[model samples]
Target: MKEITIDYALRATWQAVARMYNEEAKQFESTMAVGFTLLSIDPKTGTPSTALGPKMGMEATSLSRILKSIEEKGLIERKPNPADGRGVLIHLTDFGLEKRKDSKDVVMRFNEIVKQAVEAEKLQHFFEVTETINKLIADKKIYVKNTTNH
Candidate 1:
């Protein structure tokens, strides 16, 4: 018997969850990405494009394209900045807000089930580890990239 490395465990976990999401819901990835970030952002201020790009693991141009597509689909709208005439604020439309509600519910239930399935101590460990990783990525821009020969 061999001990499983944390990286292996995380990869397995992500793959399992991603597969489940793919099978259960179409657009799960994109919807959750926008929905979760929008939920975190202030509707009044919205998030600055400069801050949002790196925080969301997206490049500025890529993020812009995504926003444009989403806006065209009627999920979001851009508002002119009052303070800075050249700036624009990203905001969720009614449809986007509704999707956020649904996404939040699904995520909450999924988290609850995971909590029940995992032992308390182990779950706490996972929480700490994930939080550490998230903070590292968010605050320090550190990402663990795996490069392997195919």
Candidate 2:
């Protein structure tokens, strides 16, 4: 591991960002996951409960736990979705809207600072590289299996 790998860099940077967000969320007695969940819900129309997991790239069990916790905190409420009898819509309570604003501000501040520190061209390149990586993985181009046996 003399030379850093792309995955190592991405993982390290993500972990650092997660840690920073969690720390900032602590002031409001919340966690990064909760803040993220709050931001994911539609502020006005509400989001389908089933959609939250996939929308956040999170598993159902983890999202269920977060939803329960936030529900207990009075940040959100689940209501019957009129569009679908069996589906539930997750709506942000008034308190949740306030917290969502805080989360948005925290994220915006991070982006603002990063944009200020990094040159515009470099930042664009960074985004392009990440997008390429995502596309490669999505297309299953990174790891191909050999069918021929030697």
Candidate 3:
């Protein structure tokens, strides 16, 4: 049998999960992806696409296209900045707000189901593992190359 290293194990887990969610929970998946990526921005201070693209690990052109599609869907709004004519800011529409709330509820229910399946003692460890993985990939320091290139 082939050895299953940490990367392989993690990749298999993520692939299986991606397939499951892609098949059974596409709406929830997209909402979760968009929400986490977008909501990371401060509500009081809007962020430009250039700043957002790097943080979300998205290519600038791809993120722009996604933003345009979502905006056309009426889930988000984009506005030109008065401070800088070339600058644009992103914000959620009322529809987007309602969708986000619904998405949050769905995720909470899903979490409850997962918690039920896993042992209580292991639940905290699950969170710890999740945080560790996030720190490894999502930390700005780890992916500083993107920012420096921009």
Best by lDDT: 2
Pick the winner on TM-score between candidates 1 and 3. 1
In model 2, what is the error at residue 75, expressed in angstroms?
A: 0.4
**TM-score of structure candidate 1:** 0.71
Give the distance in Å from residue 150's predicted Cα in candidate 3 to where it truly belongs.
30
Per-candidate TM equals 0.71, 0.95, 0.64
lDDT of each: 0.70, 0.97, 0.68
Once fitted onto the true fold, the runs of candidate 3 whose alpha carbons sit more than 4 angstroms away are: 24-46, 81-86, 130-150
- State the lDDT of candidate 3 residue by residue for 12-126, as single tens digits: 9878755654444466546445555445443445667667888777888878777777677787777786677898877777776765665556557767998999998799987
Ranking by lDDT: 2, 1, 3
Query: What digit string (tens of lDDT, one per residue) describes model 1 on residues 1-150?
Result: 299987788899888876655454465545445555556545556665556676777777878777777778777788886777887777777877776676677778788998899999998898899999878877756755557767
| Cand. 3 Cα-lDDT | 0.68
Model 2 clash tally, residue pairs? 0
Q: Give the TM-score of candidate 2.
A: 0.95
- Judged by lDDT against the true structure, how good is candidate 2? 0.97
Cα RMSDs of all predictions?
A: 5.8, 1.8, 5.8
